[model samples]
Target: MPLQTVLVTGANRGLGLEFVRQYREAGWHVIATSRPLDEGVRARDCGAELLQLDVRDEGAIHALAHALEGRKIDLLINNAGYHPGAHQLGELDYSSWQTAFHINVIAPLQIAEAFLPVIPPGGKIVNIGSRQGSMACNREGGRYLYRATKAALHSITRSLAIDLTKRGIIVVALHPGWVKTDMGTDSADIEVEESVSGMREVIADLGQHNTGHLINYDGAVIPW
Candidate 1:
C-alpha cells in the first residue's frame, strides 16, 4: 500500500511543525508549506517536501495545485494564521484586521477549493480554529479581529463539510489548545507536542461520521 499523503500549511513551527513531524514519523508522506522567508529546515529534516507558500497568495496556491495536479492527498491541514496582537476595546487596526481575515479565513477556503481535484474521496480537510470563535462560549470579548476571522473559518468549515459530504470528503474544524508557541506565547498552557498529538489522534479517528463538527484537540465537541 502507498503511504498516505498530508499537506500542512504554516509548517515551519508550532503546531504545524509538530503535525509535520508526527505525520512523517507515522510513515506518511508530508508536504509542508510555509511563507517564503520561513526556513523549514526542521520540516525537511523530517523528510517532508517543503513548499514555500504564503497562503494569502492566490497565484501561488493555484500554482501549487497545478504543480501537484492529480496527486492523491489524503489530508490537507489549513494551519496558517495571523494575530495582530491584543486589541483593546477602542484600539483596532482595520488594516491588520483585513490581513487577518485574508490569511485566516479566505485563504483556507480558497486553498481547499483549489486542492479539491487532488483530494480524493475519503480524504480529510482540517481547518485550525479556536474556542474564541465560538459565540456560545464567548463571555469575555476583545481581540475582535482574531475572533471574527476564526468564527468565519468555523462557519466556512461547516459549509465545506456540507458541500463536500456527497463527495465523501470530511471537513472539520479543530481547536488546538493554547499551545506555547509564538502565537500562543510562553504562558500558554499546553506544549506543541501535546496539542499536535491530540489533534493527530482526532484526525486519525475522523470519518464521515465526524464531519462538520467543531472539535477540540482532545476529541471533545465544541459549541458552534
Candidate 2:
C-alpha cells in the first residue's frame, strides 16, 4: 500500500515540528513547510520532505500547489499561527492585530483553497485553533488578537466543512491543549509530544460525523 501523505505548515519548531516527527515515525509521507529553508533542517532530518513556505505569500502558495499538482495529500495540517502577545485594552497595536488575523485566520483558508485539487475524497484538513477562542471559555480575556483570530479560524473551519462536503473533504478545528511550546510557554499544562499524539488520534478517527466542529486534543468537543 502507498503511504499516506500529510503536509504540515510552520514545521520548523514547537508543535509543528513535533507533528512532523511523529508522523514520520509512523511511516507516513511527511511534507513539512517552514518560512525559510534554513530553519527546516530538523524536519528534513526527521524524514520529512522540507519545503519553504511563508503562508502570507499568496503567490508562493499557488506556486506550491502547482508544483505538487499530481500528488495526493491525505491530510493538510494548518499549524502556522501568530500570537501578538497579551495586550492591554487601551494599548492594543492595530498593526500587529492585522498581522495576527492574516496569519491565524486568512492564511489557512487560502492554503486550503489552493490545495483543494490535491486533497482527494475523504481527505482531512485540520486547522490549529485555541481554547481561548471559545467565547464560552474566555473568562480571563486578555489575548484579544490571538483569541479573535482563532475564533475567526473556527468560523472558517465550519464554512469549509460545509462547502467541501460535496467533495467528501473533512474540515475541523483542533485545539491542542496548552502545550510547552514557545507560544504555550514552559509553564503550560502538557508537553508537545502528548498534545500532538492526542491530536493524531483525533485525526485518525475523523469522518463525516466529526466535520465542522471544534475539538480538543483529547477528543472532547469545545463550545464555540
Candidate 3:
C-alpha cells in the first residue's frame, strides 16, 4: 500500500503525540492537530503537519475540512479528550458535563461527519476510548462525566461503523489500556510507546470482521 495519511487530535501531548510520532516514523503522512501550535514542535519534528485545531470549535473543524479538501485520509484518530476534576457523581458540575460532551463525544462525531467524503474505502477510524466507560467494567462511580462521555464515544463508534460501512470505512473504538501518558499518570502500567505500538498492531490487524467492535490495545474485545 502507498503511504497513509492520518490525523490525530490533541497531538501536542500524551498518547496523541505518541501516535503522531509512531505513525510518522512508519512513513505515514500525519496531520497532527492541537490547540496550541507553539507546543506542537515535537510532533512537527517527527514529520507531521502541526495543525491548529480546537475540537470544541465547529469553525475550526470546518476550516480543517476545507483545507483538506481533495485529500484522502487513510486513518483518523479521535484522540483528544478532557477529564475535569469536577467529575464526582454527587458533586457533579453541569458545566463540566457539558464540556465533556463537547470534547469527548461531540467533536469526534463532528469530525467524522465533516470529513466523511474524504475517507475512502478501506480507511479506518480509531476512537481512543476507555475501559472506565465500560458499564461491564465499571467498579467505581466517581467519574460520572468522564465515564458517560467515553461510553457515549463507544456508542458513536458503533454507529459510525454502521453509517460508514457502505462507504467501506472501518470504524472501531479502542481502549489504550492504562498507559503512562500525561492523562494516564506515572503509575500507569504501560509506557506511551508501548500503548501506541499496541494500538498500531491492532489497527494493522483490523479487517471487515472487526468493524464496529470495541477493542483494547491488545486487540481483545471489550464488552459494550
Residue 46 miss distance in model 3 (angstroms): 0.8
Selected candidate, larger lDDT, 1 vs 2: 2
Q: What is the lDDT of residue 50 in candidate 3?
A: 92
Model 2 global lDDT (CA atoms, 0 to 1): 0.95
**What tens-digit string does per-residue lDDT give for candidate 2 at 1-224?**
67899999999999999999999999999999999999999999999999999999999999999999999999999999988865678878887877898899989999999999999999999999999899989999787888889999999999999999999999999999999999889999999999999999999999999899999999999999
Segments in model 2 whose C-alpha atoms lie over 4 Å from true places:
none
Give all candidates' CA lDDT scores. Answer: 0.94, 0.95, 0.91
lDDT per residue as tens, model 3, 112-214? 9998878889999999989988999887767888888999999999999998888889999999999887778899999999889999999999987899988
Q: Taking the tens digit of each residue's C-alpha lDDT, what string does model 1 give over 1-224?
A: 67899999999998899999999999999999979645888899999999999998999999999999979999999999988885778778887877899999999999999999999999999999999899988899787998899999999999999999999999999999999999999999999999999999999999899899999999999999
Order of the predicted models by lDDT, top scorer first: 2, 1, 3
Cα shift from native, residue 105, model 2 (Å):
0.8
Q: Candidate 1: where is the Cα deviation over 4 Å?
A: none
